[model samples]
Target: MKRRKAIRNIVLFSLGTGIIYSCKDKYEAIKQLHLKHLIIDTKQLDILDDLSRLIVPLQNIPELADHTALPFIMNMVEHVFEEKDRQAFMKGYQSWDQEILSIKGRAFSAMKIEEKQQLLSEVNEESLKASQELYTVFNTVKEKSIQYLTTSEYYQRKVNYYQMAPGKFKGDVLLVDLKNKNDE
Candidate 1:
């Protein structure tokens, strides 16, 4: 019995070390898995990169440019969206680029960082006046925000900043729906 327990402990320690090394830096692992796919048309992809980074500035964590989510997003959009919608996306992209270029005299990605932020602000204002049927600029911005926060290294670090929550729980109680709060 003593010999069996010693063997079991040795095996468990080996497995733990393997798991720890394997789990190291998920961001770096994902980046390696997705790097080759990142090489698409620079012109089309740059808009996404520039816009997403503007929405989630790089101060708190890694820059959006570091994670390559913008290229991944562009690939997904070009391949996955319906034909008509893809066409609209392309058109919307061109129109937005033109608008920003007129304001800053350069492509959105090439503009100074401050100018990019200012352009996004103006774009948001214009989106507010959009008619019901039109897809507002804010919708594009929102999608870009979703794309960045879900994939960027900054977001990943933020999410993993804390250790995992404890697993064991003592008890549970039924919860009440709060929808009737308005009636009160």
Candidate 2:
């Protein structure tokens, strides 16, 4: 009986692990397909990389590039943006790409980190010149990119940091304190 139970537990655990890995691989494949279809412009891709790194700055956590934030951002840009916003994004993307080409005749991704940072700084300055609503579009994209990359369960497991004391919620301390204070 003990041997049978142990065998059943092992089978269940193996099946669960297999399903989880399969789902992860499928999600990755879908993400890759989405990125491939979008063919995101070089400038937008560069901006996305910068934004992702900014939000999830390298520390104990891995860099955003190690995740798929850039492709995720591109997918969002392709589907979720309104037509006008999309056009605006394309314009900004092209202009940034052209600037890089004129400076180094290479894509922004190929540039050195310092050069990329400088270019992004310039792009940010240009974005600021736009109207508030227009500027907000880019900001929205940046925020969503970070949120999806960092918190999505498919990419990273969500951790609950809250530690609750046992029987703490049912304790009468709060009521007693309130009653005493009222009497006083």
Candidate 3:
């Protein structure tokens, strides 16, 4: 009887352990994404996510909570980017936080928003001595962020609101002013 109970307990424990391990494995697999040409691990994706959040700044505004540039940027990087851009992106992505660590003595996860912003600004201003790849990554990310933001539904509707009106609303002295300006 005691042997039977011991065996049962062992079986239950083994099953539980297997279940837990399987779940953990599945979660880990889901965490890191495998792109066709580029592999963006969870950590790298998080950094990009944080950067996107920094650029668009959706946290402050309630309406923009649903809008994000990260996904769009990722898709573009996966599909639209050329081989050279992809190589530069990978090199930059790898060295990006490392440069931050060298300069700030901390990783992106440890820094505040302002600190991150300052670091990126340094990259833009050519203040930080980063590699060409780093600069490429910076430029690409910035350009894509703006592109995504401008093309986003929220930007189209609220931020970039334009009224549809029919035609030429020139000033009173339009033709004369144009002729005089050209003459000058």
Best candidate, TM-score: 3
Model 1 lDDT tens row, 94-160 = 5666655664578666777787677667656664233321243335545755775666555554543
lDDT, candidates in the order shown: 0.51, 0.53, 0.68
Per-residue lDDT over 3-104 for candidate 2, one digit per residue giving the tens place of the 0 to 100 score:
999978976865453211233342453345443223343335545556556545432355334454555555566688776666666555545545456556
lDDT of 1 at 106: 81
Candidate 3, clashing residue pairs?
none
Ten residues in sequence with the least summed lDDT for candidate 1: 18-27
The best candidate in terms of lDDT: 3
Could you tell which candidate, 1 or 2, scores higher by lDDT? 2
Better of 2 and 3 by TM-score: 3
Model 2 TM: 0.45
Angstrom error of the Cα, residue 175, model 3: value is 15
**lDDT of model 1 at residue 65?**
48
**Cα RMSDs, all models:** 16.8, 15.3, 10.3
